[model samples]
Target: MMTRAYIFLNGVGEKEEFYKKLDFKNSSVYCADGGYRQCLKAGAIPKEVWGDFDSVSDSEFKDLEDSDIILRKFSKEKDSTDGELLIEYVSSKNYDEIYVLCGLGGRLDHELTNINLLFKYKNINIKTEKELLFSVDRKYTFINKKNKIISFVPFSDEVRNMNLKGFKYPLNDYLLKRGDSRCMSNIVCSDEATVDFNTGRLLCILND
Candidate 1:
């Protein structure tokens, strides 16, 4: 079984209804500053909350004063974003997988930063109601997902020696370069599909 961690971010209004339906009972949950509001709205309590509190109002902070949840406060002039801090903290604890909720559909810069983190930490995945985003290093397999819209986005200059199996448009050891549209919008044709590469990383995005 995989040990999972759920990290909540501030930008969740776009898929608020979908996020509210998530069950955080089995996994460890953490909130980043204003993300605590989202966690509460989802009827889940966070194990810890880490941030500078810049995005959280004073009243909100005061309400958690008597709570047992661990609060790690930082300076407003910090080096990292609130989300980064929470991710690092959870990553250090050796969680098998980290699912970032409500990290997408926010400010463009922040959204890109969250996506970039996937390259650094392969165990991290940003999930929304309609899409699942993660990094694929050497190889990745999709199980029990037939006819799903899957896209392999090249993160490096070139994803070399790639082999796509069980796809609508399969590739045999092909070089997928950046800005190439060959790997986009492909559908999974088998219950177990796979993408293999010799070198470089790819962002594997799956749409439901």
Candidate 2:
């Protein structure tokens, strides 16, 4: 039952450092279209490449095809974004953990959409940078921030039974609504912090 899933993004000007942090040997890597270029540059091959060939170059696609990487091409006239499509594909598999690299620092709209996808999938621990984000049914927690800022915002209805520990402004049985600023700008007071939401979708942001 080892953790075995990864998603790589190949947007414009992705940093090389992030790819170095990944353990490609054991994880099943997936790319979002042009992401295959970044995978090859990192000396890692993807198990599947999912997206419209819009951002992918012809030579790159040919190379991937030659390399035996499975390409799940979608039409340019599709509903879900390529990243979202990849997420759905992985959700069908029984992976314990999913790491997303080259996901941040891309288009602003894509970044926002990727963050929202966190709420759609549970059971699998999704991590980016050094932050781990996951939800247990209705509750979500962000951890592994050594000295970082963790902020929470309710994405659905008001969040209830909110509790915070190991933070500068600890909360006890607090209720957070859409317009509440009580959970903003909270710093990690310990090696790690925990944020639990009882009944709502929350966008838990962790900054290093």
Question: Model 2, 42-136: lDDT tens per residue?
Answer: 77878999989898888877887787778888899989998888988787787877766666656889876776777787544445555554444
TM-scores, in order shown? 0.94, 0.83
Please list the residue runs of candidate 2 whose C-alpha ends up more than 4 Å from where it truly belongs after superposition: 12-14, 123-137, 140-147, 190-193
lDDT of 2: 0.74
| Local distance difference test, each candidate | 0.87, 0.74
| Residue lDDT tens for model 1, 1-208 | 8788899998754345785566678889999998898888777889999899888888889877778999999999978899998888788889888889888876889899988988876488888888989998798888999999998899889989999999999999899998888999999999999999999879989996
lDDT of 1 at 173: 88
Pairs of colliding residues, candidate 2:
none
